[model samples]
Target: MWSRALRSNLKLSKSEACIFFKNKIRGASTCVEGEPEGPVVKTDIPGPKSKQLLQELGSLQQVGTIQLFANYDKSIGNYLVDADDNILLDTYTQISSLPLGYNHPELLKVFNDQHNMKCLINRPALGVFPGEDWPKRLNGILSEISPKLPNITTMMCGSCSNENAFKNIFIAYQRKKRGDVDFSEEEKSSCVLNQPPGAPKLSIMSFKNAFHGRTLGSLSTTHSKYIHKIDIPSFDWPIATFPQYKYPLEDNQRENEEQDKKCLSEVEELFEKYEKKGIPVAGIIVEPIQSEGGDNEASPQFFQQLQKIAKKNNAYLLIDEVQTGGGCTGKFWCHEHFNLETPPDIVTFSKKMQLGGYFHTAEMTPRQPARVFNTWMGDPGKLIILQTVLRVIKEQKLLDNVLHTGTLLKIGLLELEKEFCYLLNSTRGRGTFLAVNATDSKLRDEILTKLKAKGIQSGGCGSNSVRLRPALIFQEHHANIFLDKFRQVLKEIN
Candidate 1:
């Protein structure tokens, strides 16, 4: 049925056809041919080889976060091959960046095309000397994947995208105030000196526990972990509480609704407080779902109201979809689920999108060039890869795949939460971007360690949540493997 549907809806290339037919069996053990049938833990996770590699790498720089050294050549599909030859089913998906898993055939063939190889090798300072096809390329790709916003500014990564986006927000804000006028001499000179009227005392309000990025500007807004911010000077911008709801949402509707109200009320208060402090908020930035902060989710109504608050305060709403975009939440962008009255003023994305950038309204476009730019505003090479990723996603109906696989994964998690009530709870999130809370941070770490030992490489978030960030290609069979392993771990703990 899947193969017939693919054939009828679109013409598959010889390679694509092979991929589909190879995995067409009703209960196939693996999706990618030559991929492992199941994980093989030849040794402990960071077994001898990985430890030796880590020791060697530690000499160059800080390796505190090094887990295991991967042998990319051996990895395929959802399995990660470590230096020790241990094959682990990877649910974290390279911190949720690998859209198609390791070395997908289509992606590998991308550079085989001479034009693409040229794009990759002959890197240009895109800001000044872009290829003639750059505009056409952007239009073609953005036409397929962009949010409702009409303008876009390509960037390098999540942090750089968010950092540059702050410039756009501030520029637009001041432009509105100084409508149709050229900058005065004082404004120009003051800006160079980092003073008022030019580099204004405007602010971008962010939510507590939000992770925008780690760059200086974006870092000020990031509050996920203190280690990422300790001793670093930050702006005193307003910080509002994000909605925290009790789980099994149907059971605690009233309390959750009240929680939404409390958060929204706090947002309003902060806007007023910041205005009184003379650093009026120029914009409000938030994550659709706080991925790094325990996969925290907010109600659709909460977001709808939040958007209204931003508009009322004459501030732009920037939905930082760095972790929630690119179909992870069953929709291409997670905010699509909110049903807002209007599109957000800015929607920043990275990770699965292949490159960093923001979709924004025309109002956010700077009056002058170089106002929001860098040497390589963005890599044409990444766009080439993204072109293929988007094509595969559409041609393969991967968004629908995400919806189906996510249902299986979330249902299994909910069931586990019930069975291991003392050890687990709060199974939450949309699509494959789900998470579940353990008894505490300590137990959460233990659960992750045990799962890793059992050949399931998952990840944790916030204080105690296990986050699932599987690739879009992840299917029901993969979900079953994870659930079976997770159940085993929970049973052993119980």
Candidate 2:
């Protein structure tokens, strides 16, 4: 029934069919072989069924931010099906985490093995009593994508991964400072009271408009929004200005270079200011691309210089790949594009990787057994899925697919910006990690709402930017559908 509806709704001209839909799988994308050809907007977005489900969920817990309830069973590939049966092309891909899209047969077969099932059910306190296979499994993860780091400290989510990473940075910093000396009685006692020289005033310098995480330690470095940290107590850390580049990078080369210099100078100044104020910066936690805060990007030079700044201050550089990792930006890690002098001191990840964890250098290794410990450090179940995810990513050459699709997506956005100059601009990003700024915040929200009505699920960041986070499986055909719909919507609004 869905396939029939799709065929009728997407019966295109010969040229259009050749460009978009081909020999696609039934009920999948019209253009792709196994996904829906086009989005289906049968009812008003967040239609009655979704509204009813949301109300039910709200009664049980907070659902104030719930826009619509998904019918997970019906969702597939690059499309999400809401409870009302509205099928929307999901460019944001659950905020850029769904790697292979919903129910990719490869992932579903992961638990088919009885051994895999056993591992999933028999949870372990990995910090203390890891399973026999734990060593090999972790090694496999590290070997494939460790950012040249030697060790892994697994945690629960992006927030905790970063929180524990903060602890690791502090411990390593103090270890270097104290020169392997045992803690003095006064030092121990002062720590209990959370005083200086024990608790210490070390800070992690972060960029303005950067989002690390929401845990107490990570939240201290997050500068994205007020809602996430409004009532929460935060650390008084140095907030360096991030580069705010002008659009058409080539056209504004001089201006953008100035922007980078201005931001980099502020960082240099903050380091001096923090030191003089007696709160030494022990580390810097940053997203290569400032996601959530905005789809703001920096030049390769910016990252290269940022690394130098950290090294000069003897600070650990933690690249928070929680959002930008897992092949979204065409690389196994987004920071790989920077061509840094050395791998970052630490790299944190979660989201598409299926679990939260930090990979760090041997220097960052904790001397004490339980210093960065947690019960059930991370779910083995998530590992099982991750193992499969990694395998599928390799077998299907998904990283290459991302690079291909990302270029197509960025080009479409650039072309759309040209036609709708008043409404869109600043089409920028690496790989599929792309975005365009709307005229204003109000128009941004309106565009997002109308896109959903036309069966496109996009997200907003910074204040006025529309971000695109299509899955790795997203192909040129998918880009064409998106561009066509985008053009239609721009015409509607313009």
Candidate 3:
């Protein structure tokens, strides 16, 4: 029954199903079609066919977090379709990774280009033998979005980008400590055995609820959930408290300022303690807005002071924009909102950029090349896609759209909080990267489940916060549609 309903929803033909790229990709004429007329739901979410497919997938792997199987071919614009044919207005956008939503025309056009096809089919080992055009491609893309930093290093994803960035910090720190001398024979031999004088006891400082990644070095800095770190061996790195601001920010300015002071003080104390213990902190890493840790935010003053603290303690600073970058926060780089006196020593990104890498000042560039190297540093195919995405962003002025829509979302969430005071509070965010807290975890889960059934898919973060990570193309009309459905859900729960 659900399958039949789903077929009706798509209204597609056999040839259309085989090519599947019709209507979405346009010709030499480049005008984009506006947003579709809201979402269309053909069946209940996770209808019978979806349940059977999920059971089959579960037998093959640990499919615990699987929500509904996606019909990638059918999903387009801002709407998502599941195997059961239920269509949802997707606000989560694949854990905040889909930049232009699904199947944007410009992205689809890459398949027709012969050069892009060659790059995709023949992956190169970037460290040893890159294609001749590799350097030119790197310069063009990296320079365009190079934050305030001058150099760029590419990697596979968020985890490895940060893990290698951590290594870059350690290498720079050790090089500074050694001054002009060559490594001692003892130091060289000891390093081979993973010991001191070579391996070193340096560390990276992270905030209490921050998340860098899940690899060994990056995992040491990730503190969002214990389950991610349970059995993995980690370093004894320092973790400072990130400021917990109060709601209706205008009403709690003084208290929020006090919160900032208390957290900054704790960070200083940890730096001193770690130094005294001989495990000097080589770097400090943090998210512009703590997305995984409940969307916690800090004032620009807090980040400015934090950078000063790092400089005073002779530690490098790395800003992880894996989840916050690519204009979700109304700026190309979210940290740009902080108005820091200088760019951070390193800024790492992945997610929506279509690749993972870090930007750094010339001083932070590794003295050795292969020391910070990887296979296929990042795929050329992803760069081709990023080029198209970047073009669309500029031509369409998507950043302006983000701001226009974000205000609507923020205001709506605030009004909802007032209407459902007992159930929610503390709405916060920049641009469309917004979130609000329920009184507790159980209520938060209920809100999320009901929102999905209503055809609006939201995601939760930290403990009790529902985060909004809409695509850059999200507009005022889409925001209104979401607001209306969300209000209806709140009414039912009340």
Best by TM-score: 1
A best-first ranking of the candidates according to their TM-score comes to 1, 2, 3
Error of 1 at 379 (Å): 0.4
**Tens digit of lDDT per residue, candidate 2, span 1-494?**
65444334332234433323332322222222356777999998789998888888888999888888898898988889988889999998887888888878877788899888888888888988888888999999999888999999888999999999999999999999999989878888898899967888889999999998888989999999999999999889999999988888868889999989998889889889999999999998889999998888889899999899889989999999999999988788999988999999999999998899989999999887888988989988898899888888898767766765665677688889999999998888877888899999999998998888889998989999999888888877777888888888889988
Better of 1 and 3 by lDDT: 1
Per-residue alpha-carbon lDDT of candidate 1 for residues 1-494, written as tens digits (9 for 90 to 100): 86565444333345544544454443343445677878899898899999999999999999999899999999998999999999999999999998889988889999999989998999999989999999999898668877888888899999999999999999999989999799999999999999987888999999889999999999999999999999999998999998888987878889999999999999999999999999999999999999898899998899999999999999999999999999988889999988999999999998998889999999999979888888898999999999989888887777767766776687799889989999999998887899999989999999999999999999999999999999988887889999999999999999
Per-candidate RMSD vs. true structure? 5.6, 6.8, 9.6
How many clashes in candidate 2? 10
Model 1 CA lDDT for position 293: 81
Local distance difference test values of all predictions, in order: 0.89, 0.85, 0.85
lDDT of 3: 0.85
Poorly placed runs, candidate 1 (over 4 Å): 1-31
How many clashes does each candidate structure show, in the order listed? 0, 10, 0
| lDDT, residue 248, model 3 | 77
TM per candidate comes to 0.94, 0.93, 0.92
Winning candidate number (lDDT): 1
Query: Which residues of candidate 2, in runs, are more than 4 Å off?
Result: 1-33
- Give the higher-TM-score candidate: 1 or 3: 1
